[model samples]
Target: MEIKTKKFKRDLLNWYKNNKRDYSWRETNDPWKILLLETISQQTQLDRADTYFKLFIKEFPNPETMASSSLKKVLILWSGLGYNNRAKRLYESSKILCETGFDELYPNFEVLPGVGPYTNNAILSFAYHKKVITRDVNVDRVFSRYFGVDEVKTFIHNNKKTLLDRVSSRDLNQAIMDFGSMVCKSKNPLCSSCVLENNCKKYIVKIKRPQEAFSGSNRELRGDLLKLLLSNNKLSLKKIEKALAVDREKLLKATTTLEKDGLITIKKNNLVEINS
Candidate 1:
């Protein structure tokens, strides 16, 4: 029996081969570099991330070197890129991977903290050309609209392998990522221009709402705080709470979120940056 996802995979792959962006990660085979780009791009856009990625390579050329680095330098380089924790996690992951005692690049994502499935596949596809499925917000929307998935976490964590097993992970990841960026965008979805429109869940369901359903997001706030502290160098919890104008709990939540995400380190004197 033919699999139920054949048409979905076919349409997506066809669309992908014909209409894809010339992204920076596509040009390299370095796992460490791919990992860096993946880390920097978390909750951040590609345009902003590309700039830092280049700078990151210049600053920390190797895994072992980056593992032995400091957060002030990382935060300085991370600069405009937000969710500073991503940079911290990148640094920590580098250290973790380095501690494994392998001299070359560490491509495995399962053991890497601060890394999710999306990032794992990014390294595999862009760095190793391995068939991997990627699902950022874009891919998730593509999944939600097409596969009757309204809950983001469900599809990413539970239903991903089910859908992706029918397609090449690399192609599926690339396809949906491009589909979201180019055709299935936030405001106006170019449905007519999209190749997978026929099989698109959103198109089939006749729904037009973007992933705005997943709004009230913490990304922008996190970015703002990181940039502020990186520039100002040590902000009191009170100072940050006032400047941001958020409730104490919200501010505290953001801080904890960032810390857990590996963006900053707290000490007796101040909240210090751990990644750039």
Candidate 2:
């Protein structure tokens, strides 16, 4: 389960080279657009993220444009992207970058709001061609199954030299992501079609998990509520409750939590609006 063999690397990289999808984000080295793609893509799916990326990039284009825009306008544009909090975070990060500059922003990962370890590695590896190993949930799943080891981060950290020696870090990381998404998916993985079929340990071991439903989840409620507010600057508590169509208690909980998170705010008169 260690993925220590050179053949495994060769097969995965080769498969990726031949089968990877041509995403617009993959074609650029622009740090601003790269940051926008990564941040917007955090919780959104691939197709939807790309759609939003096209729309958002068309409107904002770069850090300066985004930084200059108001948070409410940004959230209005970002309405359907869900996790609307990211829009605000992206705007804040853009302001910081515009002031400090991308040259400073790229090197100091900590300065960027909402940019975590995976995103940091992605920015460095893809945008700067740095030899950093980027592992998101997809890459982690692929490594766990292929290597037959559960400690993905540990495995990658320990085996970086061997894993990355034969390929460019950007290509290798991109290959892992593409392979995971296309072949080694969470459910019903296309093992027969996978190039790594001969090398994957999980193909023999067989691991599975249940998919979580999104309906009525806190995230769904929050997103719905945000959408309602995004279209209409503020809404009366009664109006929001009626618009959400969820149980009163659940709606209240979502709104209160959103207020605490600074994604929304409630006036004394009970009108809710996106936080300034």
Which digits, one per residue and each the tens of the lDDT, describe model 1 over residues 182-260?
8778657787776666665663334545543223357667777787777776677777777877777767667777777
Report the number of the highest-lDDT candidate. 2
Q: What are the per-residue Cα lDDT tens digits for candidate 2 across 1-276?
A: 234556778888888878887889897888888889998888678788899899999999988998888888888888877777788889899888877877776666757888888888888888888888888888888888888887878888888878888578888888888887888997788988777777678834345465456786888888888877777879988888777767778988998989987888888998888775
What alpha-carbon RMSD in Å does predicted model 2 have with respect to the real structure? 2.3
Candidate 2's C-alpha runs over 4 A off are 1-3, 203-212
For all predicted structures, in order, the TM-scores are 0.68, 0.91
Q: Residue 58's C-alpha lDDT in candidate 2?
A: 96
Where's the lowest-lDDT run of ten residues in candidate 1?
A: 207-216
